[model samples]
Target: MSAEEKKTRQMPKGGRKGGTIFPRIALQDAVGYARRLVSKTHTSRQPRDVIYSGVVGAKAGIGDVRISALKQYGFLDGDAKSGYTADELAKKIVAAPPEELPHLYGQAVLKPTVFKRLFDTFQSDTVTRAKLKQRAADLKVHPDETDTCVELYVASLATAGLVSVDGDRITHLASADMSETAAISVVTDENNQSLSNNSTVNSPATRIDAGSDTEAAASDIGEEDKNGFPVPPGNSAQPAPRANFNVNVTLDSSMDIEKLQKQLELLKRFGAI
Candidate 1:
């Protein structure tokens, strides 16, 4: 506990200022632990309740790692010294239908550093084991660490359906079933110009076929309006007025795949799913 010893302690290898660690537990384990924590009571005075209830033992510090994983994933909030407390988001996740837990955990676990790095680096359509190694090299990760990272990625995120990994190929889940906000409808005219909400729209006239009238040409004088136009009442009907709407989609072609992939992950982490 001396000043020099404190300086040497700095922080654990992969740990930040807080006790939280990048997630190490698989998706199922994380979800199961979260569900169990929801049924327990955690008070400010008894923050250890979470660790005690969810983790088996501190053997080799596995228990600490698991607790840290939970905290990193937002299931349990607070640090080791302060104990852990389950927040509203955790409660909702626990109460969510069993089928939906994987998806929820996927989003939450992606917040960890390891997973975030993997996601961001492999945002392309297909990422192989070689690609993973290349990414590791680019990030200055040790060759040995690359293998471990790939294994961890498969066990957690890929297994959770948050991503796809076939053999060595990896893909970002761009079309995942994520929740979207209500889009404002912009009414527009045929000229592609935005129109006011109160604007009136005149629908096109509906055309009807007259019964095989081969002799209708002989009745030109039989039905003629004051304007000298043929008045075929049964053959033509005015269409009802209706609102015309146009959805304006502006695509930024300059945006590359990596940037778009980051946005998708960002949406997931914020619970837009």
Candidate 2:
């Protein structure tokens, strides 16, 4: 391949880079796929077509995002050409009792360097969806996928019960064993500051809940944050003309239709003016 052609070649999704590309699907999604495999194939490697036919979604197809997620979580093994089978961790999860799932899933989640880093960095600190996005920006995540990355990461965290969301205030919960680390107690002070591992952290100032998921996620991660997903520049003609305006709105957890309508109306009024 010529130098220019090599530069044009796409980067491999995960195995090669740590956190450059996060899991497209959530933990529960990967769990669901593995659960189906346990019921149908019992950990045996089966042909790609067979697995695809047996475990199909409402969309009539299982996507690469899901397959990649399963692999990242150490839930699935083998390749499309070599066939696919549920890995040992997957077998254990399927066999474990109800209460053990969160613990097991927590371990699987941290396998990805990105998730692991986030968990390590934010496990002790108060985290908002916006805060996570900011951290992602710090990690050089692409602007276009800022919301998507946070959404999927939040989904995984929610599934593992790692963080509890309440009206934009996220209280980090003690999850599975990180092996090298010892267990600790969770205590909340009068001000809702989390005290854990003998350390104290005041509640975050931005108590914005993670309920709306993507509302505050469109934060800028810089123009160069093209982590394999690039956000192309808009055409010159597409820029707003008359109502040249920049507005910052704080959308609360009460994202009811009425509230949404009001915000929409406000923006529409600007356009009309």
What TM-score do all the candidates reach, one by one?
0.50, 0.54
For model 1, the superposed segments whose C-alpha errors exceed 4 Å read 1-21, 42-45, 53-60, 140-143, 175-273
In order, the Cα lDDT scores of the candidates are 0.58, 0.67
Over 4 Å off in model 2, which ranges? 1-19, 56-62, 174-273
Local lDDT at 95 for model 2: 91
Cα error, candidate 1, residue 118 (Å): 2.0
Best by lDDT: 2
Give Cα distance to truth, residue 88, candidate 1, Å: 3.5
Best by TM-score: 2
- What tens digits encode model 2's per-residue C-alpha lDDT throughout 136-241? 8777677677788877777788787777777776666543443322232122122234345325233453345533545543332113222333232344465433
Score candidate 1 by TM-score against the native: 0.50
- Ten-residue stretch with the least lDDT total in model 1: 180-189
User: In lDDT terms, how accurate is model 1?
Assistant: 0.58
